[model samples]
Target: MNRLARQSLLLAGLLLPVLPLAAQHVDHAGHGASHARDPMAAAIAAPSRTPANVARDKYRHPAETLAFFGVRPDQTVVEYSPSGGWYTEILAPLLSAKGTFYALQPVGRNLDGYKTFLAAKPDVYGKVKLVPFPDQLSLIPAGSVDTLLTFRNIHNMVMNGTEAATFKSFYDLLKPGGILGVVDHRLPEARDSALEKTSGYLKVSTIRRLAQAAGFEYVGSSEINANPKDTADWEKGVWTLPPTLRNGEVDKARYLAIGESDRMTLKFRKPAS
Candidate 1:
């Protein structure tokens, strides 16, 4: 072949391998560009969130709680048993732009209510993926989630005798190095497992043991949701504190002063290996 023809062939050969990589970069950028500019901020500011939900920020500390778990704007997060979508209001909008938020619910009356809540606010919650968790968390795919969060729900799992299975499922669903953010009513001291069931309280030691047994490493704990005033020995357990005030308006003022239960916020991780 002539000199010009050979030079052209050499240039083409050098560029061939780089073509696929260039295409991949463009594809990734395009995908990311389609997401909201700042999902976390947008979610927090979403107008569709109910006023009552916003009012609870003082006790729930949604932003700080999620931050403690290292939740990123772009991640696949699954919230276990979002019965009333309290956190859903924040998560759906925050993740709607760039990440996936899965609301896992069991089969019950709350399921219909949860669906209706999402349907009513399509602009903010339309992207939320609802997974029917039922008994055993059959809906979550193994090693698919970056973060798995459960709020005040562990005691119920223990009460129903599915605690171990549920933890195992959580372990299975997370990617290696994935985070598990657990928030539950705190028991001042370790109590018998059965007694804990009735009190809606759990000891940090017991929680750590359970999570470690399921192959997760206890990374750390945060006091972002702690309320020192809560003695946690109410007549109706944690529910007697605020929101629930199981006694109705009997001690409404007292319970209102205490706010919500003193909760333990913990972070655990699946080993990267």
Candidate 2:
């Protein structure tokens, strides 16, 4: 080979190792940028959300709560019992553009009202797929979900004696590596466990046990939705707090000051195998 050609070849060999390093740097930088761009921001701030729902953001901490569950914008997600579409307002929009969002409403009167809410905003909620869960659990094929979430509804499951079946259904619906994100009113461990059936609050251990029984790995828990002011003992249970105020006008100011119920934010994952 000519001297110039040999020199060129030598130079190419020397730069080859550096090329991968440069590419790796670019990839790492891009990953960081992705995190900087919060996926839940737009959904949380969307104009379609009702003013009342917006007011609840302080207590809900939707973005942090969802992030703790590792929710993404490109996965199949289901929300169990999206009554009144509180999280629905955020979740449906978050998944509409790239992911599939299912509103798993039970077959009941609330389903009709939820339908009305979605119909009113076809543009935002138009892509939502509604399934009458438990009864219609088969509507979603087994092992198809990436994440299944239930917010503030497990107490009813315990009260109705369907908690086991509900957990089984969730386990069946999630993919082998799927996630279950749960947010519910927090019941102090020292408090009477029986209150779970009557109060809206639930013990974190109760959820962990049920989920573990369903074959999910206990991933972790977050305090994002916790409120220290909530004592979890009230005349009307959790509803005595704001939002429901089941004991309206009796201590309205106190309830309003306490705001929403203290909640436990938990994450569990289906075994990858």
Candidate 3:
């Protein structure tokens, strides 16, 4: 080969290796840039808390219940009667950067305890907002919330004679097409009368009717929190299980095995405009 041609070929061979290296570097950089722009990706990459990591000693189907509600990292969500804020510790951090998290405490109720609890966990719950409700849903602004969630709190309202107003309030707070997710202790169909007002259990059908009456369509139910072993009969009612274990230290082992009460996970949706 001529000297000029040989020189050109040598230069091309040396540049070929550098071209692949430069291409690889650009591809990696692009992938990192894309991930940085994705809020969900970033949240997962540095997850502050997950259901598996939280202390759910009394909550059943923690992960499945949340997933069925279609909770995202980018939506406004309000948790009703967030007693002690167990879920709040995880949720506030999860939605802090990408969404709004509101803890709706009932009005006239002392919240000094809750405020103190939150103050201790600034890193995870820094974005949380405390919204007070005046013992009624009318206090919630119209078309303001994207999602409303209540977990195992319905029975108390029902037994206390506040079920109708509570459901109506839930219906009003949701935006069109928004969701109202409820998880509550379940009462057997035939045992409704005997268990509804006393035990923590409520008939699933009753909940469905209430939701429908409040302008929400019953989407469906889930067995995520069902416990076949729970005969639904306990001396102290649903509180006989762990966390509450209201029986004191007696039969602690047996009750611990029973875990929390059997619950029903129900989803209802407000009509879309």
Clashing pairs in 3: none
Worst 10 residues of 2 by lDDT: 31-40
Q: Candidate 2, residues 228-267: lDDT per residue as tens digits?
A: 9999999788988999888869989988998899999999
What TM-scores do the predictions have?
Answer: 0.83, 0.85, 0.78
lDDT of 3 by residue, 25-53 (tens): 99999978876775444443345544543
Kindly report which residue stretches of model 2 are placed more than 4 angstroms away from their true locations once superposed.
Answer: 1-37
Model 3 residue 126 CA deviation in Å: 2.3
Regions of candidate 3 where Cα sits further than 4 Å from its true position? 1-53, 57-59, 108-110, 135-140
**Candidate 1, 203-237: lDDT as tens digits:** 89888988999999999999999999998887678
* For model 3, the run of ten residues with the poorest summed lDDT: 39-48
Error of model 3, residue 71, in angstroms? 0.6
Candidate 1: segments with Cα more than 4 A from true spot: 1-38, 135-139, 190-193
Write down the TM-score for model 2: 0.85
Candidate 1 residue-wise lDDT at 53: 86
